[model samples]
Target: MSLLLEEISIKNEHSFRSKIDVLPHIEVPWHHHPEFELIYIEKSRGTLVVGDCIDNFNDGDLLFIGPDTPHIMKNEDSYYQKKSDLRAIAWVVHFKEDSFGKEFFLLPEMSRIRKFLTKSFQGVRISGSSKYKIIQHLKTLHSAEYSQRILTLLQILQVLAQSEDLEYLASDNFVETFQQRSNQKLYQIYEYVSKNFQKKIELEEAAKIANLSKTAFCRFFKSKTKKTFSAFLNEMRINYAKKLLVEGRLTVAQIAYECGFNSPSYFNKTFKSTTGKSPLQLKGEK
Candidate 1:
């Protein structure tokens, strides 16, 4: 499926958008934008999808997603029922990398934060003391005026930069797959893989989608994502296999076929190589 491109509106007087969303349910769907997103869940319970990662989220969860990454925080089914009284509340902020200034992040003083921003491309989950500090800043940010808002956001980034209690949300290669969604060719390639990974996908077919010769497409895809097309496809399949393994509903062989692997042995080998754990081992753990 194609992801929607979301347009975020920033006030004329402000360089960034920060607000608290308190609603019976979330209205946004799976969408992406060309801005960095920082969000803290004040109160909620749901599933969060970012790039190739899918996991549960609870109250007090904090997340950071870089530009052009597709994401969604979908509430549980009960929250969508008309008679349900549950509420989803969160503090969200959106800003561009250059929102502060073109040279702001390039300064020597911003080295750590600059590196942190790069890591955000894979999405981040902040926890422990860092989440606590960032949440306080997020609350202040929503109501701060003028310069104070900018300062608070900087403080949030500073905390994120120095903190050790952090976990990356998306797979390493998944971010590269969607980081240039605005490019039509890249979007077509990503969409095609996302939709048809459960079936046989030939390199020639993918080359045709990109309108390039097979050799040119292979080199182009490697240049853009730093991996061979086959490797990328294998990672995609392995990621899905992991999710299915976690759910504990399907047998390993069935999951291998479901994820488009030609054989159970090959699936086991690829799964172990990619994640450092065999499928049955993961299923047993779950």
Candidate 2:
């Protein structure tokens, strides 16, 4: 499926929804919604795509995403195996700005949180002490009563508002582009690239996938994602390479081939150009 606008339901007894989600894999395809989301991955390792950002996520990772931002967390191949008993688990919370009240966040006491939520339009990864603190609050919120849940959520937001451990995910320009025009064709292209980047990906193949002529597809892809198709695919490959480098189980040459590079020299060139660090250097530092 292309980009989906998922409709989330809130019970009458709850102003916002909070629950623990467990699955054999992340079953939600690329999708967006009208609610702000905070997710704490309790157990998982996967590729996380938020708007135009693609990166790796593991257990204990936390993210806050704004409304209408297309995103997904796709598990590794191991999670999809029927014989494997691996499970993905996360504590997820979804709420609208008006969930408390239309004017609740506009109050003077809520100024910091209001600003923080506005910044979340670009999506963010919480790390360091901030992530640990929020995880504690999320655990309580997951099992809390109605009023306690409200208090705990407010506490979570408060910590986020005052913290400096936030890493913004999607670029500002990409967020604007996605919000203005969410194209099913563009989403389809993203899905195809994400799945096939390890193999030889031709522009003609992508054009056929989008059902557009090559010239039109180039223009459309650049207009929608603010990057050439080649650049986007290279980014996806380099991101996976970075994760592998951190794992420290492979040599640079092996990692280059594993991440779909035709040669180690070219992989070194591209890796440095993209990340300003050579693969060996990054691995050593890690």
Candidate 3:
């Protein structure tokens, strides 16, 4: 329902932050921040939640997230085993809206990058040759001096701004759902719903999780998620169904029930409405 705000500070009084993190698995919980985020997933596969978009992310996943957009990557279950061989490595970049000064992004020459950043409000997945080019620049950014890093970052943005192979995450109708500074309470609600969404969730339970009254919680949830609680929950369930569909181990009806839909017909309708494809259609496309 809500996400915690993550504060980021760069050392040396830099205007931005960049880091390469290597770990057995990603452990960060759902969160958001004021800085724009660019992350290259060097290793591992997992479920990634960006805004209301939930999907799987694999190695070489490259994307940029807008300020205050909630996101998190949870390693697949196997990655959590005691003796798991998998690992997660990432190159992460974070920068403020004014990283390049107030006038820079406003310049006519920066029109492309300006449009690109504006599109980031919904999250973006960068791909194709431009994605490879950006990864190379991100790799070198850690070693480059202050000036060179800035130049290379601009280059990366320029390439991305011009690229056609990009995917926008989150629905077009999605909007910011909650006010900032709510802290971890929203994340608690998210985690609870995510874990229990496969089962019916009552509004009172959700309100209790958020510590708000049921009447207030309904309005609060809608305001924060740009959709009703039922819609939000259904979207999440559909995301799970998407994963199970790709697994191809279960019938569509079975998958629907597993995803918490009461009937196969309703599941089919909602799946088509949400994902623009029926279960059979998705399977056929696969």
lDDT of each: 0.85, 0.88, 0.83
TM match of model 2 to true structure: 0.90
Tens digits of per-residue lDDT for model 3, 54-148? 77788998989988777778998999999998889999999988987978899999999999887897889988898999988998898898689
Q: What is the lDDT of residue 186 in candidate 3?
A: 59
- What lDDT tens digits, residue by residue, belong to model 1 across residues 1-286? 4567899999999999998889998776667898999988888887676776655678888999998887766788999997999999988999999998899999999999999999898899998999998988888887899899999999999999999998997877666666654556666676677657889999999999999999999999888778898998898788778878988999999999998999999999999999999898999988
Question: Candidate 2, which segments miss by more than 4 Å at Cα?
Answer: none
lDDT: the better of candidates 2 and 3: 2
Look at candidate 1 and give me any clashing residue pairs: none
Deviation in Å, model 3, residue 215 alpha carbon: 3.9
Steric overlap count per candidate:
0, 0, 2
Per-residue lDDT over 27-66 for candidate 2, one digit per residue giving the tens place of the 0 to 100 score: 8788889999999999999888886677788988999999
On TM-score, the candidate that comes out on top is 2
Q: What lDDT is obtained when candidate 3 is compared to the true structure?
A: 0.83
Clashing pairs in 2: none
Query: Could you tell me how far off, in angstroms, the CA of residue 236 lies in candidate 3 after the best superposition?
Result: 2.7
